[model samples]
Target: MPRASRLAAQLQDEYQAEVSLEKGRGGVFDVWLNDQLVFSKHSVSRFPEDGEIQSAVNAHLAAN
Candidate 1:
């Protein structure tokens, strides 16, 4: 598993949004947020992917 996938799994336990990684065309990976499109980039760019996920998680936490 990639670092981003590992971290996202951890985040999911504390947040309401669902997280998953989908292997995409040209070996790219996509980060899905609440079943919506969010971050789609190379698997190597995990930090930015995590950051984007964190933003959505934080927003959901804030609203509740």
Candidate 2:
């Protein structure tokens, strides 16, 4: 599966939150929650590790 599809599945299964993926040029992969950036591959120059984004989302959900 594609990265977005994989992450979307994980998020949907775990949190039941709505997820959408947008295609970007030049290898842009970003994850956003509630208009807030949770992960940005471009910024870090690397993809998130396993559970990295999930953890971020979890923290974001907990904080709100």
Best by TM-score: 2
Per-residue C-alpha lDDT of model 1 across residues 1-64, encoded as one tens digit per residue: 4766676677777674466555555655565655564555564454454366667657755765
lDDT of each: 0.59, 0.90
State the lDDT at 63 in candidate 2: 95
Q: Please give each candidate's TM-score.
A: 0.47, 0.92
Distance from true position, residue 54, model 2, in Å? 0.5
User: Which runs of model 2 end up more than 4 angstroms from their true locations?
Assistant: none
Highest lDDT scorer: 2
Give lDDT for model 1.
Answer: 0.59
Residue-level lDDT of model 2, residues 1-64, one tens digit each, is 2978998999999998888878888989889999999899999999999999999998998999
